[model samples]
Target: MSAATTTEQTLARYYHLHARLYDATRWSFLFGRSDLQARIAALRSPQRILEIGCGTGRNLARLAHCFPAAQLIGLDLSADMLARARTHLRQHRSRVILRQQIYSQPLAPAPGFDLIVLSYCLSMINPGWEQVIRSARQDLMADGLMAVVDFHDTRWPAFRRWMAVNHVRMEGQLLPELQTHFQPLDSAVRRAYGGAWRYLRFIGTPRPIVHR
Candidate 1:
């Protein structure tokens, strides 16, 4: 199996086991989610929004509320996660669409979404995170926005190792790549749990694609 496939399988199994507990436990550590959404709302009123790795639909529900007229799509690699998302977002069912798939490439019929979000999801995507970043650029409309909130890195080795076991790589890696593909609109890194770790929030527009 390819590295992406392997990572997907591992994440599927992980979420399958943890889906029930996810919403309950995540709020303690998953900082910047609400802030990220607020920042996105400040920037644009997107007509169509997509959230990659929209586990349990927490942000999807928020997006539905924030942009009531918008069409929302939540894509994930875990059925378990999407199943929870389905329940969590049922009130907005008419506007919300959930899909179970690993996002390795652009969705067909290019220039798809006005806003794409990744909330604490990219860190777990070890080998294929960069590919997903590029794919997000491709999937976006010419003036599309991409917003991300995720673990940045930790100073403690033990904490880093623990996160690694959970399939997250936190080494302050995602920001530079995101900057490379998108023009920065808003970006910041903040400490979590009194310096236990750091998390980043970024909102950017797709940089004009250069074709040779």
Candidate 2:
């Protein structure tokens, strides 16, 4: 099997096992999610929003509250995870749509999203994280936002190795790559657990392509 396929299957299986415990367990370490939401709320009143790794839909639920008129889509890869998301987002079920798919390509009908969010997800996608970022740009409107909050890096090799086992790659790479595809409106990197690791929060619009 291709390395990417292996990575996808491994994560699907991992989430299948961890789906039930995700919302409960992720509360402590999934930092800056609510903060990101609040930041987005203050900055934009998007009519349509998409969360790339909506997981158990906790973020989606929050977005629904923050943007009552917004049409929201929660896109995830694992059925088990989306199943949990469905239950978690039951109150806003009518406005929220959930899909199980890898986000390698732009969504059809062209640049439909007003805002696209990547929350603690790009780190887990091994071989194709950059592609996902680029594709999300293609999936966004000319005037659109891309908001991200995710692991930045680790100073401890042991901690890094442990995270790798859990399917996360935190080498402080995502933010720079995101900047390549989007222009920064607001961005920050913060230390986690007394600098043992770091995480980034960013909100940006698509970088204009300069024709030569």
Candidate 3:
């Protein structure tokens, strides 16, 4: 294989090797994930839901349980991750589509989705998340729900902030180019652990469409 292909293969191997232990080891570091699940459940009318960075498809499986009839699509940059996800989703018996792609690229260009979720994703992508969000906005249907669950600057009590800072220092290196991308939308966060950590959730409502 070519050098680039070889490198990609090596990385995929590394991810697959670690995939089984990923949830147990690294899952707790991603806090406030339950909040995302709760909010998606409350949407009440989501039809087509898209999940970016769907590693191992655990969340997609959870979503299937939450909304039995909705169409689900998951995208990720690593084929190894997608493979694990497929295995987890094999018995769901729902229409779950998995795509191997990075969030830096445009979505499938299929107009839009009823619900779009970014859960602990931006902090691990290439330096184009803003572009990705713009693409998501364009790919959303009118009044669609965009839910984000991610680590934040964690403004809270003194001790919690210190812990958050340290945790970010450890894992944030993987996403060194990521910026605080939550300011534009009307956003709120639930702060805990002396305010050292928070989970941010934002929703945007596009202007209404008028039929000609």
lDDT of each: 0.93, 0.92, 0.65
Count clashing pairs, candidate 1: 0
Off by over 4 Å in 2: 210-212
Q: Pick the candidate with the highest lDDT.
A: 1
Angstrom error of the Cα, residue 123, model 2: value is: 0.3
Best-to-worst lDDT order:
1, 2, 3
What order do you get sorting by TM-score, best first?
A: 1, 2, 3
Q: Tens-digit lDDT track for model 1 on 141-194?
A: 988899999999999999999999999999999999999999999999999989
- Pull out the clashing pairs in model 3: 56-85, 112-139, 156-195, 157-194, 160-196, 161-196
Which segments of candidate 1 are over 4 A away from where they belong? none
Give the per-residue lDDT of model 3 (tens digit) for 1-212: 55534544544566777777877786656776666677667655687888987888888888877888889999876777887898889977468989887655557575568778887765433335566676676667766776766665544456444644332222323222222322224456566566656555555444433347
Estimate, for each residue in 69-105, the C-alpha lDDT of model 2 and write its tens digit: 9999999999999998898889999999999998989
Model 3 lDDT at residue 29:
64
Q: Per-residue lDDT for 86 in model 1? A: 92
Error of 1 at 49 (Å): 0.4
